[model samples]
Target: MSLLDQQSVFSAMLQAGPFAVGDTPPLAHPFSRETKAWVQHIHGNQLLKTKYRSVRNQIFDLLGIATYDEVLALIHDKELRTKAAERAYLLLGNMFGIEGTGQEVIRHLHEYARTADDVISSLRAKVLAPYSAHIETTNEIVTTWDPVELLLALFDDRYHKKARFEAKRKLALMGLAGSIDQRERETKIGEKFLTFLNFLNAFVWSPDCKIGELDIRYLYSTHNRENFSCSAVKVLSEEEARLIIPAVGEKLTLVKRRRFRDNGADIPIYVTIRKKEPSAKVLKLLRKNEKNPATAVDDELGLMAVLNSVNDVKRFVRHLTRSAARAESFMTLEDISDTLTGGEYRGTATGSSGKTSMLKFFARTGGMRIEFILHTNRSYLNYIYQRDVAHDEYEVKRIFDTGVIEFLFPPDIYHLDLQKIRDHQLAWFRRRIEEN
Candidate 1:
């Protein structure tokens, strides 16, 4: 059966009952061999075995296998079992957003298998459809823009086309991002991080985010129309575009400043509350074994403070610290503000030099851990628009360099050698930077 058909079968098995019967019983199905091998692989690996134990019952129940020993007993042919194990890891990893090979791949898959459905349900609830009230705008000032427009700014700015096709192609290559399985996996892994960001959004607008007589203002974004409409993706501000242009690679170069429009609401500094994008979250999980979909929730909620001056950025942090202390609700804090304090400049991807600058930390408050990223106007500009140090460029580099693009988008399926495309994009992004 095709992967989609396999997914349908598993989904059906999970949803309905009366699992095994007839000539093609659950155990007799073609998938049974691969699953049996998967069980063996998990049993053989110590780290994966521990994770398997936690969700052992769920796995057996979902797969319609009565018990662990029952599945193992059927694993007869050693060579066949070994090959099946490899195939199982690769296909299942692609479907479920698990990364890497061997023990770690099985570990991520097992850890999240139990909760995939729940994550899907939660995401559906949040994504309001058919033009409901925009609740995200009621509390804070929200500026909305079409994601297609952002893409247009890059790829089809002069042409005014290709955004939809490019977006669709990218999504398909990225494991059909809109698929039920991928959505559930991404949401489950990034749940805590997203929750923490929601908490921060609430806190920012609350009276608590104040400095004595002065109240802080935060500008955020949300879908301005029906969830499935063209307006699903919002607009990026001039400052936001800096990070986005490089982050988005070469296709999204439609930076028409004159066309950029929003409600004429002014705030001293615009605070962008970003819930880490789902694709980025998946890449992060694949990047390391130490993080799982559930327990690892730090760095999910990113708060980017774009200030007018370095002095303003410093002042904002000082006030933020005081406000958190005043509430007496903070659990722990890491004041990693080397740039603001004139301490050792330890910034950049490698942490060797101080070139890539930003003041960042994790704070536990409102029962959620959030990463606060503070950047001065000048620094923020450089971070996004700079030739070698653009955030968008870094995103492009990691997606290709880590082999994630290839892993998720296999040649047989995508029919595109993404490494060459990666090189092309990196070069195109560079040219765009140099030109304007």
Candidate 2:
């Protein structure tokens, strides 16, 4: 076998062998800090994070159970997997980068099927097979659900032969609903309290929020955890802590979170839906507000202001596609310009071929630099080059020294719809969901 494969087999054998019963070290630190760090990396990664709705979604993929960190803490608690199949399921998911709550739970109802009748024979048979016994509905396109029974069914094994109904149900829902900031509080504290207050107050954190903390030793060094404490974790929430100390000694702490704010952390995007008000009216509201929206730099690297690093656009195209009625709710370029005192917003471009592109700030919460690219309006020359092409070209050229500018506005430059962009991101929760 290849070196990587050999190492994996060795590791599995180590994990599956009669580990604790032997003279061997029992694979001390069975999991590496890399695993912990990678999870933390996902939590800190703004782009990957923006793809997820909350931390619970990540936990579902990371840990088969909502409280994966709890599993980590089990090192201190000494919980063992009496049922290896379910443990294998979680292990394989982690090894293969297939952690998200995806179509698998629904698609494999019978494929690779197993049964409880064989649980007593082997860990593979017991855990994997018994799980198949609790099949509900299966389809290529699975409906999203929060079924308590489904989760309980996963734990059916020779060891955990009978499931804990209420316990399993609450655990499943916690992973389904919890956010990243909530995940952070399991270790540190700051944003969580602010978030809980916001949920109580009815306002919430900015979508793709940016937060940071600085290193105080040099006053402005790259590693300033102390100085940037308040800004470290971006997503925040309020919650009632519910931690259960399993008799097995695994402590599961779940906080149901609510509340948020625009703490001006460093992040790439800050999105908020404009409800009821016409897209044009929303700009007027922002324009009239005296509190200027903070940029990624104000609270991050202090290099580029957050405004320079991010674009605040109101466009959810997938929603528009499914509901044609919502199309009219989109904001126009004029509205964006009017919203800022001197906002430099080039018109959005859409192509006849349905492509798009635009200029935007790619890095946020850090350097907040700007770059031009084609997105959304992938081939929308027909949208911008029709009868108004020459006239608009002259107007734009008069505004820039490059008497010329390529329009990538229709599709590739500036377009983001959560549902549609799935095909373009790396996810642990869902498999190959990005359709493009």
Please tell me which predicted candidate would have the highest lDDT against the true structure.
Answer: 1
Candidate 2 lands at a TM-score of 0.17
Alpha-carbon lDDT of model 2: 0.24
After superposition, candidate 1 runs with Cα above 4 Å error: 1-61, 65-267, 277-279, 289-291, 294-297, 330-332, 335-337, 340-354, 412-415, 434-436
- Each model's Cα RMSD: 17.7, 25.7
lDDT of 1 by residue, 296-350 (tens): 3346666777665576666666556554555566546675655644555564322
- Runs in model 2 lying further than 4 Å from the true structure: 1-436
Clash count per candidate: 12, 74
Give the lowest summed-lDDT range of ten residues in model 1: 135-144
lDDT of 2 by residue, 359-422 (tens): 3332211112212121111112211222222223323222121110111011121222322322
